[model samples]
Target: MRAKAVRMYGTRDLRLEEFELPEIRDDEILAKIYSDSICMSTYKLVEQGKKHKRAPQNMDTHPVIVGHEFAGVIVKVGKKWQDQFQPGMRFAQQPALNYKGSLASPGYSYEWYGGDTTYCIFPHETMELGALMPFDGDSFYKASLGEPMSCCIGGYHAMYHTNKQNYDHEMGTKRGGNILIAGGCGPMGLGSVSYGLVCDYHPRRIVVTDVDDAKIERAKEVVSPEYAAEHGVELIYANTAKMDDPRQGLMDLTQGHGYDDVFVMVPIPSVCQLAGSVLAFDGCLNFFSGPTDKNFSASMNMYDLHYTSTHLMGTTGGNNDDLIEANQLAASGRLDPSVMITHVGGIDSIAETTLNLPKIKGGKKLAYTQFDMPMTAIEDFAKLGKSDPFFAKLDQCCRDHKGLWNPEAERMLFEHKGVKVEV
Candidate 1:
């Protein structure tokens, strides 16, 4: 069998090519991918080329598929997996495979499997041990959101400093009493917003700060005003590029005490420093975005941390259990992950679409296994210079409904138009 895939030949060099599919081993299951979302790190790896240790090491590389977040249906299963996963069963998989003696799974490493292809072969360990989640929902796109949502779960876990006996026992809230999400316009940031709303701690207020005006506007447009009003969540749109003291604005927002939980979704060193500056007593700052270079460092007051009891931790990827919980969250209808999807295209556009990740805004970029839409087509829809019919309708919907959409209505629209309403 032949399948379409995006092969990373080297840094900044990716090609859409056809590759022979490996025969399903007795312990392997074959999946037909329906939707895969472009990750920020995928863009980073493509641009960084050989500098990315996670990329294949040589030209003889196996033309590894380059995606981690996706949802698919079981197309074929080996004898061993036949009893478990049947053909046509919809599912989402955590692409991390841990063949190493260590328990940790192979996430973006050379030994791991990726989802940015038309089909994939996954091992029994991944399929049976909760790495692959069965989709009970109507849309594959919503299931595709599991990977990022799991990462958000990991970030929240990292942000909680359980060692603080007093706060953990008395206040019952994790490390930071209140949570602050910086650079909240991105998909990861939005994931944080969704998770924050449902977290056990239930911070007094969830503050989302962003630099992009358009994204800020969109955030306000997508996040339900009723949810915000009920949860006491506030969206702060600030110009970080021109601000002399971004920390000052954060401090002011927090009533000068600072936030108990802060997730720095942006990799900028300044954003890290700003997170550190706005931490409340015994607060924990989780660097949600992995720094691109080892040289990247942020400054903070050691005295403040020692006296105020603050912690700084960072995490990457997520465990299989996290993905299961993420899928459950989305399927519950409490959170609409589809609203986060902004672009959709096929493997042919992966190269150029990934190259422009830094410039793309608003929501997640989805790569479809069946569509042939080009990068330009999506850009044209987004760049109608504010006159785009979609944007106009979206704005009207937001205005009339106060930034929330009826998922059922949206589903009807997509289904009526045969637009593949996943999520």
Candidate 2:
């Protein structure tokens, strides 16, 4: 089959190209990708390219496709997978295959198996490892956002607090405890907030901190304070950009008790240090962000770690179980991952959009693979509507969902006018 995809040839070299995919083997499955969410980690992969161990070393031999957060439909199932996955079934992936202790993953490691393409083949290893998960959901974006959401869920599970009695550790975030999310205005930050509130984390108070007030407002629009209150969760937003000490406000919010669970959303050392500083007794800090710097280190108060029993940990990506949980939550309407999307576009613009993702403001950039339209921000939908009625409908749909995209909008979009592609 002929398909369009974004390929990374080398460092700072991402190109959109046409390619042919071979027939699926007996142990393989073919998927037609429809929605892919752009991630900041892709930016690091683009800049680092072959220098990164996760990416293919020889670009000429393997011009890798560049995206991981994606969702699609199963177009063709191999002989082995026919009973498990059928044609026209929706699907998403865990992506962090980590096959046999190798550094390779689908988006960064594979030449023909990334999310940027219209169609991709799932190799035997992926099937064996159980990374490709089938989902039943209304919005494809929800499936695409599943991987990142699972990352948040995984981090919460990775966190552990030491028991004063047994001296052992208890895993997972504390229920009915005060939670803090540092740099909680970005896409993942927003996801962490929504998931922490909705799922079983059950935080008594959830505090989100960011430098940009506008971003904090945007975050509120996604997960309103009133909505949090309705869920029996106290959601607090703080701007630490102007404060002399960012941790002071966090401590104040908890009445100088400090946070029971701290999730560091930013990769900077200072932000990690700040997250650690605001830890309450028996607090567990989960460093959620992955940094490019090899020597990135944050100072830790060893005395606090030993006496107060606070500890820190980090995870690169979620396992298969976490992805399944994310999908289940989205399907059940308990979790709305679409709040993470800021801009929507077509496959034609994804190459440039992904290359310059760091410069682009707002949250996740979502792509409708068959659509040919230029990138449009959700905030600019009203303006775009004046020029085109299609965008006007999209504007209403997004507005109906409180300035965020949803399954109804997705169906209405394709039913009204989407770039039709017959695979």
Best by the TM-score measure:
2
Model 1: per-residue lDDT, tens digit, 263-323?
A: 8888887778888888988788888788777788888889978988888878787777777
Show where candidate 2 strays beyond 4 Å. Answer: 416-423
lDDT of 2 by residue, 15-119 (tens): 888989888889999888988988888888988878887987787567988888988888888999777778888888988887899888877988889898888
In candidate 1, stretches whose alpha carbon ends up further than 4 angstroms from where it belongs are: 59-61, 101-113, 162-176, 232-245, 376-423
lDDT of each: 0.69, 0.86
TM-score of 1: 0.84
Candidate 1 colliding pairs, count: 3
Q: TM-scores of the models, in the given order?
A: 0.84, 0.96
